[model samples]
Target: MRGFISLLLLTLGLCLQATGMAADKSVIAVIVTNDNPNKSISLGELKLIYWRKKTYWANGQRIHPINLPPDHPLRLQFSNSILGSTPSAQNDYWNGLYFHGISPPHVLYSDEAAIRYVQETAGSIAYADACKLDNRVKPLLWLLPNGETTTNPSFVNCN
Candidate 1:
């Protein structure tokens, strides 16, 4: 009976621990095409690119910013991390832009979709879990929660 009770308590504790861990967001790397000439971008510049303010890269290529569906948790985390805003903030911004007949970035359904889109499209950028990175996309910046950065030696050539 004592062993059964101990096992039950241990299982409950692990379940609670997993729940808390799920709430903690991790670092995301902004990925672009592997052959993109622009090696790096500042956080402010990246934010503007997403906002559609910085519409083109240095090579005169239109920058296509890709995003996951607004309801996705990682999408919320990306919006909060990069823009200091929520998904509703984006909806409001886009609604305001629509008055002028302007549109927003392409919304992909998953990180894999974003990766595929960026690879096929020139001057595209998107954020994804660092662990999901592949050779097709070159990470330009590694962003942590609360606006911090780390240079990813293997992923980004931003030295």
Candidate 2:
């Protein structure tokens, strides 16, 4: 309760000591399971993961890619920023992949669920808002729609 209250006050920028704490620090990022040995994540690799082009981790563990629910803003951002199109535009591709037994990434309902899943599962990765990030999961990379990429970001909450 105390933690939630503090977050609420900080979100409103109304706490006496929360004056400069900005949500601007938040971003869309790729999060991978802790056991992953990859030192850096790239946009190209993320695209391959979503396209089901990349299937295994370095240690031969199957990589489980996760998709965000359609209603989530990060879903659209991910679609455009990473997939280069909206979900509808890629419907045919998804269908073709399905026909060939190449399924799309599994969908998780929320950022929290994605984070928890990644934390508990090996070789799993998902895209989510960095604000919800913490020590429980490691963010592989942070990408802006403008083509900027951040590796191992220092999120305010994680600090």
Per TM-score, the best of the predicted structures is: 1
Give the local distance difference test score of model 1. 0.83
Tens-digit lDDT track of model 1 for 43-105: 889889988889999899889999888877678888887888988877889998888877888
Compared to the true structure, candidate 2 yields what TM-score? 0.77
Each model's lDDT: 0.83, 0.79
C-alpha displacement of 136 in model 2, angstroms? 1.1
TM per candidate: 0.80, 0.77
lDDT for 86 (candidate 1) = 85
Task: Point out the worst 10-residue segment of candidate 1 by lDDT.
Answer: 150-159
**Tens digits of per-residue lDDT for model 2 on 1-159?**
999998997877665444344323347878887767887787888889899999987689999999987656678767877888987787789898887899888999999999999999989999788777778887778866454667746532444
lDDT accuracy of residue 37 in candidate 2: 86
- Candidate 2: misplaced stretches above 4 Å? 1-26, 145-147, 152-159
